[model samples]
Structures are given as C-alpha cells and as structure tokens.
Target: MTSMKRVLKLCLGSARGAMVQGGALTVLVLLAGVGLLALSGWFITAAAAAGLAGAGLAFEVFRPSAGVRALALGRTGARYGERLLTHDATLKALVAVRLRLLRGLMSQPLRRLERARAGAALNRLIADVDALDGVTLRLFLPAVAGALTLLVSVIGLAVLVSGTVALWIGAVYGIGALGIGLRFGPQALPVARRAERALQAVRARTNDAFAARADLTVYNALDRQIAHAGHAATELAKARAHRDGIERAAQFWVTATVQLAVAGALGLGFMAVTNGALSAPLAMTGVLAALALSEALMPLARGISEFGRIADSARRVMGDIPETVPELHPRHDAKPMVVPPLDLRSVAIRPLIDTLSLTVEAGEMALLAGPSGVGKTTVLNVIAGLLPPDRGKVCIGGTPLTDHAEEDLRGRLGFVPQRTTVMDGTLMDSLRLGNATLTEAEAWHLLDIVQMAGFAKSRDGLQTRLGSRGNALSGGERRRVALARAIAGRPPVLLMDEPTEGLDEATATAVLKGIRAYLPKSAILIASHRACDRVLATRVITLR
Candidate 1:
C-alpha cells in the first residue's frame, strides 16, 4: 500500500500543475450544467402555466435561444480548458516516469541489466511510460471531476425541488453508472494485461528480426518472420476487441436500467399532476431535470472504465522494472574526496558464476586476453565503475567509487563497450557524447590521429551525418570513431572491449598509435584476443 501511494504521489507531483487548471475548468462546467438545467426547468414551467398566451409564447421563444447560447459557451470553454490541462499533465508525467526508470537502471549492476533484454528495457521506457498518459489525464481527473459534479448537482437540485425526487434521480443515475464501471472493471484487467504483453512481445520480436535481417534473408525465412509479426498484431487486436465488448455490454445494461427508472419517474409525475398534487408545468420540468441529471453520469462511468485499464497496464510496467535500485539519499557531513589522483588497492573482481580475479594499477594499459565467454567485457565494466564487484572494493583517489558521486566518478573514466551504441545524430553529435565542449579543431585532430581525417574531409567535416549504429561508415571506421570518442575527454582511466575487432592491419595500427599519442598520460585498459594488438600495450594481463 505504501509503495502504491508513493507511485501515485510521484505521478501526481508531475501533474499537479495541470491539475489546478483542470480542476478549475471542471468546477465551472459543473456550475454551468446545473444552472442550465435549473433555468430550463423554470422557463418551461412558466411557459406551461401561461398556457401559450402572449407573454408565455414570448418567454418560450427567448428562453431556449438564450439557454442554448449559454450552454454552448460553457461547454466550449470547459472542453478547451480540459484539453490544455490534460495534455500538459500527460507530457509532464511521462517525462517524470521515464527519468525514474532510467535512474533505477543506472543503479543496478551491469550484469543484472544485461540479463534484462535491451528490447524489454526499451519497451519499458517508451511504451510503459506512454501508458501513464491516459492514466492521469483521460482517466483519473475526469472521473474525479464527474463524481464531484454529480454530488454537487444532486444536492443543489434537492434544495430546488423535493428531496424524494432528487433522491430517486440521483440513485438511478449514480448507481447505474457505478454498476457499469464495477461490472466491467475486473474483466478489463486481463484484456489490458494481455494486450500489453502482446505489444511488448511484438516489439521484442520485431527488434530481433531487424537485427538479424541479413540472416533471415539468407535463410529465406523473411516471410515466416513477417507472418509471426502479423500473428502477434492479430492477438493484440483480439485482446482490445474483447475488452471493448465487455465494456460495451456494461454500458448497454446501465443505459437500459437508467431509461426504465426515468420512465417510472415521468409516470409518477404525470399522475401527481392529474391528482392536483403537482402542476402540469412542474411535472414536465421535473421529468426533464431527471433526464439531464442522469445523462451527466455517463462521462464518469466511461472515465472509471478507462482508469481500470490504465491501472492494469501500470501494474505490469512497474513489475517489469527491477525493484533493486537504491533510493537517492543525501549526506550532511560527507565532503567530496580530495586525495591521490587514482588508487586501486588489491581490487579483485570474480564473476558470480566464474572463478577469476583481475587487478590493475593507474597509468598502466593492461590487456585482458582470453577465449570468448571468459567475462572479459564484464571485467572491464567492473573497473570502469559501470558494475559493482560482488565481493571486492572499488576505490579511486583513496575513496570508494560507491561513496563518490556517480557523476564525478563517471567523469573520471571513459568506457567503450564491445557493441557500438550510437545515437541518431551526426558524427559531431556522437563525439560530443565523450566531451560536449570538444572544439572543432581538436575533433579533427583526434580524427586524424585515428586515420579518420580523410573520411571527415571527404564529407562535410563535423556536420557529416552518421547512420544509426554507425552504419554509414565502414566497420574499421566505426571502431576508430568509437575510439576517438573514448579518448576525446582524456579521462584519467579508459576501458575498451575488443577495440580493434573489425579494423584492418593498417587502420588497426593507426588506432593503436592514436591511443598512444592522445592518451599518453591516462591509464588505458584494452581487452582483446589479438596477439599483434598486445604489442602496443604497456603491460598485458591475460585472463583464462
């Protein structure tokens, strides 16, 4: 319950600004609706009492046009206000939720994150966060506003008319609408969950297919893969159809029940008029007021049904994120570390499933050479502060890496993983990931060192766009570009995994030479299996 409350609070905090605006608009609309209904009842009663005489006929002529204009203005204003506030809140909440997810992932160990698929993480970030947009804006606020409107309107109408009449009207409208929501709410949950799962599966499968497009084409299995995607999409549509059908059935029953209750009220009003207990105009007015009051509850019922679906999706999304990320805590008396430049005292890291310990010193380029699956990249991640050792202490400049601020520690080291993760941007944008303030001259100079100057020269220098995953450039060129990015910041320490994997002999040598020239003072650690590459290292630390 406490966790749920915390999540709600986080969501509300993001949307509070828009809630204020929406709440105000909701109040105005409720007032306008009540006023319109009351005034229309009074005017109709007056016209009936006058028996269509001269003044009565004139009153009827002006009242309807006046009511229509006022109602139109109120509805238009309310809708505009509601839309403005809801959209603003939706966007704000999405941003907050995304940031929270990112912060959570950042705190976890690299190996744990790797265990979670990339597509799953991406789905959580994009689709899961998007789920909350409807939750807060379309579902929560509107439902709350509608309920308030019904309550206030019912109380006001009771004061204007008989308590019994108001009670009958409120009960018929409110209970019917509430019943509709309750009946379909539970059924909607399964459908929503299945739909969300299907969407995630589709996303993951699509990503896998695209990543292995060449393999699929070579094996002539492209048609089969496409058919699989079609099936997933079909499943999603079926789930949606099922949920909608249930909701529609609920709405149908609720509407029928409300209509029967309204018919009963009108019959009672007519009998009262004939018996002289109520006037003819009063009877007609009472019937109209009851119908209008009942209609107002429809939006509330729809909002509740939508909210149920959002809640279901929210549960699934939150469950997908690992609950292990530590909450941020502030320190009062702790000062930043100020000591030796870099220090690693007997640091030993062994994988949870393996038995090996690797250690290195500052200002030394140690190459971890071993067969595949020996956790070479994992070892580098541990050293680069991207992963925490299971049973070892990681200290830099005499302070534990965990104790130091994450941003400060990250600034002290550079890491380029085996898989190239390039954002959708120009070459300069990619380079800026290393150091945002890297000057144009310095960028070109670094490119020259990596033998990429000619490529940049052929293009339009820093403005040249690089395709996704560095697809625009050759394999060796991509490796060099990544290398240049790693050393751009000239951090105190550098960690590289398979740095020369795709480079040709000449380009490989040039990349090695560039690392030596640019990072002459920084501690460089490269993990590779190439014997020729080991010759460029200051010291080789081989792993089994």
Candidate 2:
C-alpha cells in the first residue's frame, strides 16, 4: 500500500471502535445539512412566488411547512450526533496511536530512543495527535457532503430557472472552492510539519531544563535556561502563526471568488428575466439558490485547509516511530533442548565500545568482575537477548539462544539492571510482574525469599504505595524490590548488575545470601567489583 494509505490504515485500526459511531453520525449530519439547505431554497422560492401572485407572503402560505420543520429538527439533531461521534472517534484514535508508539519504543533498543530528542516524541504523541481531530471528524465527511449538496442545489436551480446561469455558477464555485482549496494543500502541509518540529524542540528544551533544574539552580544558570525555553516557545508560536495565516489567506480567496461567481450568475439571470426567457419570480429564486449553493463550498474550503494540517502532523509523528530492530535467527531449525540446567556456550559480547567472550556451564555461579568502563553489562545483555552478538552464539542446553523466539528466551532468564526502574503503583503491583497470576501468599513468600518480608511487614504489607520511579523507597529498597521480582519468576538463569551496590554491609550480605540460595538450581551471572568470598562464584572472569 502507499504511505498515506498505510498511515490512514493504522489510524483507522486504532480507532476502529470509535469509527463505527463517527461514521453513523457523519451520515446523519450530511443528510440533515442537505435537508436544511433544500428547505431554505424552498422557503425563498415560496416567498418569491407568493409575492408575484399579489398575495402577501405568510408562513402559512408555504405548503411544505412540516417538511421545513422536520429539516430544521434534523439539522439540530445531526449536529449533536456528529459532535458526539467525532469526539468519541478522535479520542479512541489517540489512544490507539499512543499504544502503538509505546510498542514501537519497546521494540527498539534504549540507545536508539535515547538518541532521539525527547521533546519530539512527546510532541508527536500529545500535540500532533490533537491536531488530527479535525481531519478524521470533519474533513472527509463534510467535504463529500458539501460537494454532493452543491451538485444537487445547482441542478435544482437549473430546473427552476436558467440552466446556463446555474451551470456557470456551479462551475465557478466548485473550481474556486474545491479546486483552489486543493492547491493550498501542498503549501499548508509544510507549515504544519514545521510547526510540529518547532513544538518538539520547545518540549525538549523545557524537559532538559526541568531535568537539570537542581544543577542549574546551583550554578546560577536558571535564568539562562528559562530564557532558552522562551526562545523555543517563540519559535513554535511563529511556526503556528505562519500556518494559520496561510490557511486564512486561502479561505479568504475562496470566499471572494465564490461571491464574485454568484454576482456573475445573477447578472446573467437578470438579463434572462428581462428578455422574457424566465419569469421574475424564477429569476429571483435562481439568484437566491445560486448564493445558497455557493455557500456549501465554504465547508469544503475549511476541510481542505484543516486536512493539510492533520496529514502533516500525523506524518511527522508516524515518521518518528522506529521501524527496525535487529533480528536473530539460527542457521538451522534446531530442536528444543531439555537439559539439567541453564548453560552458555561460545558466548561473545560486543558493546558499542568493546568486545569480550566467555562461557558458563550449568550449576556454576559466575561473577563478572571488571572496572566501570568494561563490557560487563553488555555480556549480560547478550544473554538476555537484549543485544545481539557480533560473531558468536549464546546457547542454552546446546540450543543456540538465537534459535528460540524472544518470548521463549525471556521466559528462560531473569534480569536486574543496576538502576532499578520502579513503575508507579503499589508494592504488590510491582511484584505482580514476576507472575501476573501470583497469589497473595505467593507474593509474600517471594518477599520473604528476598529478605524483604520484614520491609513489607513494616509498611502496610504489599498494599504499600510506591511513588513514581519508587521515589517513596530508598535506593536499597528499590533494588531489593527489583531483585524480589526477578527471583520470584523462578527462571533458571539470573543476570544481575550491582545487586549489592549502595546497600549496607549487613543488608548486602543478606541479599547475597538469598541470591546464593537459588544458585544451585539457576546459573547466576553477576557484574560487580566488590568481592563476596562467602557467596563467591565457582569461577570469576576479570576484565580490564
């Protein structure tokens, strides 16, 4: 499919639930609008005909009063329905887009996402999605409805009065509004793109300033940072202003051209009446109908302008989502291996900066001792399927790690990084990651296993709330909670980084003891500089 089709498909897929309601409402609104316009023309025609017949035009004189009233009611009802459906669909689409973005981020490596400007992603998710409201809700349905309404109104005018004059008015209005509006599509899209970029830059700069607020305050550079933020905001405002200006200019030209076309049609209509080709009442009705028909183009003009903005914003956001990730596939269709325990064979780890090789057999507890700059964590990442090897294979039970799907590989291992990232939730919520179906007893059991039972008991047990990033808990508590979660899953392979860092000697010893208790059943690989002779691994690899 083409790129535009693909983007639209993605949007529809996300908001499929809402699209049902929106589509129904859109149909109703269009019907109502058409009815209202037709009733309006009838009112004008009836009033003109009554006056020519020498009877004072009265509301009771119109034969189709009931139809007019129904049309008016339909217009009101359809407007409400359209608003309800459009809002529902737009919100649903936004949610779907948000979920897709999150999934994309998860599939990509942290390094790649980090390399992108933080503000750009945020702007796409927030502002860009907001911009799409008009496109999905207003642009497609209204433009189509307006075109059809214009056509029918023009045809009705031609049948009632001068056909040539009606045709001329229709052509001018259609070309000036729909055609000229389309011409501005390309011009306005770039402005929307620029606006999106500028907004992202502003968000990124503000985020950076907030993240470094402490440092900025200490260094007395807060004012400088604030000034920089103002500059970014100004840039975004300027881009938005330019886009709005272009849209306004396009709208004005369309309105002016349509009005001029109506005047010309009226002139032709007057001559036709004077020459006895058409009745005075018919001529008056023709002029009034032409003006009404021409007005339908207004929505088309506005929709085209708004569509350009929506399409541009959607493109920007969709483009930012990562499209590629390294895939791992074994050379052969290897059978799944069932061995006594976890094992790594011919495992070579190559980080962005360095490379290393190692192997660990089942029932072995190994500690990877190295300086801060070494490829210690990189080695663990390879085992966890987070990173791909440069030239070697990671195997478990003689089965290449790459041979297994990512979900299967993940099921076989447990990982705890140096900086524990605690989600915003209760303590039990974090522990539930190990096993979503874990029972209350099982949760407390794992907390006991990690020597965190006392900590949980001290608080409100598993019900204790944790702040965002676990700010409510200390670094040591966060590490223990993460460790408890990793071990709770009871995977056969455990990879830990600085599990004992920042903990007191007594707490560190207790945490190490708990980890050692699981070493007999699981192959444990830890990266740390501190030596624990009591829980020492059977083998240790020291890297420079």
Misplaced by over 4 Å in model 2 are 1-3, 13-28, 51-63, 117-119, 155-162, 275-296, 299-309, 320-341, 350-363, 518-520
The count of residue-pair clashes in candidate 2 stands at 0
Which residue segments of model 1 deviate by more than 4 Å?
1-7, 53-68, 206-213, 275-277, 280-282, 300-309, 320-362
lDDT by residue for model 2 (1-544), tens: 1334545566677777666566666555554554555556656676767777777535455456677778778767867876786687677777766666666666777557658765566666777767766656556546655676667666766776678877887788777865676677777777766766666667777888898999999999988988988987888898778877776877787778767876887788779978889766566666655666544566655665566567777666566554442343432455663542445554555443344556665666788887787778777776777777776667776677767655556656789987678888988999888768878998887787667889889989999988888999888889888998887767778889988888877777777776668546777788888766225668888877
At residue 506, candidate 2 shows an lDDT of 73
- State TM-scores per candidate: 0.89, 0.85
Tell me, by TM-score, which candidate is best. 1
